[model samples]
Target: MTVPRAMKSTMFTLDGRRGVMLACMAPAAAFFFAFWLLPTARLITVPAEKGWSAYFEILTDSRYLESILNTVLLSLVVTIATLVIGAATGIYLARRSFRGRQTLLALLTLPLAFPGVIVGFFVILLGGRQGLVADFTHSLGLSRVTFAYGLTGLFLAYLYFSLPRAVASYTAAAEAIDVQLEEAARMLGASRWHITRDVWIPQLAPTTVACGAIVFATAMGAFGTAFTLASKVEVLPITIYNEFTNYANFATAAALSIALGLITGAVLFAARLLCGLSPAR
Candidate 1:
């Protein structure tokens, strides 16, 4: 009374897959539509009765322009910092067999596990007025310099999170590189610096760029950290959040979200293009 093996295998075939997959996929797709696509559609449809007038108004606003610029600038700065710090740390961790490598890796990625709010809190605690910086400044009879609620604090939080992401991404990429190539370079009288600059860097450039772009986007869209630290910061994300929550201006929020989405899409698209251009074979 056992079922035939061929029939069982056929039942599991890709073309004959059951309702389970379809069922699962349907819910996921609906979730995406409900959470992401539907709102986006509403934003696009509701605002354009006058044919992109709202878009034009948003683009032309000084505040909007400033927010866009601020977001881009902050993201770029954080991206570069993450790339440099993360890549260098990754290379070191990947190459050298150190005693505390595992521990160090965990420590580096510690911030990633903590919520962004906690990172903001930590930065405020360490760098805010009446925090360590302020206490030290007062002790030395110097001006009590403030680090909370500004670009400096926001950047610190960004770097905290971004460095971990960069480290993890670049570490994986670095580990994939063949050790013999580096050994060969060194044996041929290439200095340590020369080996890194010529041999290691070229191989790692594409991965670094791809990871940097991701970190850049994350920084651009970051809300919790930016909100906790710098309400006056005027980044695109903060603006969108304010429009939706504070002002109840869903139209403007939608418009800004659409704009940010396009910019993010373009950045990621360019990164993919760059990734494709690299030698695969």
Candidate 2:
């Protein structure tokens, strides 16, 4: 028996929709397999060629531990500083319209165009031995201070790059917030501090956490900055590069890379969980 015309059309439509959906997803699947899954699997298994014990060696080795600790601490500090500074600036820009506001916002986000190496160089120009800071201090007949090759320089560079991202995220989040909520609170005799505390912060908490997580992850994986600044900085990315290049120690580098990935992944996962639970949503 022949199928009904309507039913036949329905079957054909469903098949066409499925085909379109699969076609759309094909490139994504191919890209994920080629780039993400393959590389991640290789990274996870390469250290195992030395034995499973190699993974645990990251924790036992003082150098590896120190690099991990330094990366974590530095990323954490940068995240906090970037969020505070970016939120304040972003909120102000989002809430106000004034002369040069567009120009100022453009300038604030200009750093985003720069790569990590460029940011490192900028740090050197600001705080290197013959830099502005040194010149100004020398002119004052005081000691010339330079920190371009140290943790301070790394922190500043990370903050410089991170700020634009944080500001952009905060601007989007703050603009989405309802202005009437703040106005209602003000009419209820709430102090500015109270209104901000009870309304704005709670609304912005999820975005703040998300922006911080991104900054932390970027800082953790930053290699060019550390590479350009100093060989002695000992961040995990530099350590991994040294292990891979200097010593030809693939196992150690792979293991450290995995550890760094895990740590960053865990923090990002936690941040996502917190975002899901945020009252702002």
Candidate 3:
């Protein structure tokens, strides 16, 4: 069965192309296996080692339930706050040019330069028992004010870190919007509120969903800030840290970690779906 020269050459070339494609894909496959697949498998299986009761602990235990509730509430509040403030600031920054505009933007993004722990420290310096807010209240002949180790401090710190990312995302999204849409709406007798509700918001919905998911996820998983600011408050991440480090309960830690990941992922997935984005996106 002797094949013609051209046929043999064609076959050889196709085989070579296939080989090259596999070679090119090798690194990504290996990386995914090593990082995502292995770890995810461990997280899934470790909890079952202690029986299905491990998963129940999250719902059954008071501490874990409280942590879950607090984390969800805080993340929701932060996400809503971030989206409202970020969208307004981002649209304004995108539309108008003024003196020191770049400087103002740089300042707005300055919080991103600090890590969560440092942001927590800053919150404390502003609101702690011995801090400036306390001193000011005392000078005003009021009771010494303290919010540094409570929900208020956590909220501010979360907002501080989450805001810059949201602003940047919303600013870029706002800039990419078509100005002609707004013009068309105006020509059709749309008021400022109408234009915003009809034009800007509809266009920015995807960005809102994206930014909301990010802020929510960050708040849910934030550790350093919660660790620094938590004397009484407890969030899921803090609970996971306790299970892993303090109690030496690897199975429970794995279960909690998986639960956190699932909750965050579910929110992200649902947001993408609601905004008409592909679930995989």
Off by over 4 Å in 1: 1-15, 18-20, 191-194
lDDT of 3 by residue, 103-196 (tens): 9999999999898999999999999988899999999999999999988899999999999988888889988999998999999999999998
User: Per-residue alpha-carbon lDDT of model 2 for 192-274, expressed as tens digits?
Assistant: 99999999999999988899899999999998899988655689999999999999999999999999999999999999999
> What is the per-residue lDDT of model 1 for residues 77-191, given as tens digits with 9 covering 90 to 100?
9899889999989988987897989999999988888888888898889888778998999899999978877888999999998899889888888999988888999889999
Model 3, residue 78: what's the lDDT? 89
> Number of the top candidate by lDDT?
2
Query: Which of candidates 1 and 2 is the stronger one according to TM-score?
Result: 2
Models ranked on TM-score: 2, 3, 1
lDDT of 3: 0.91
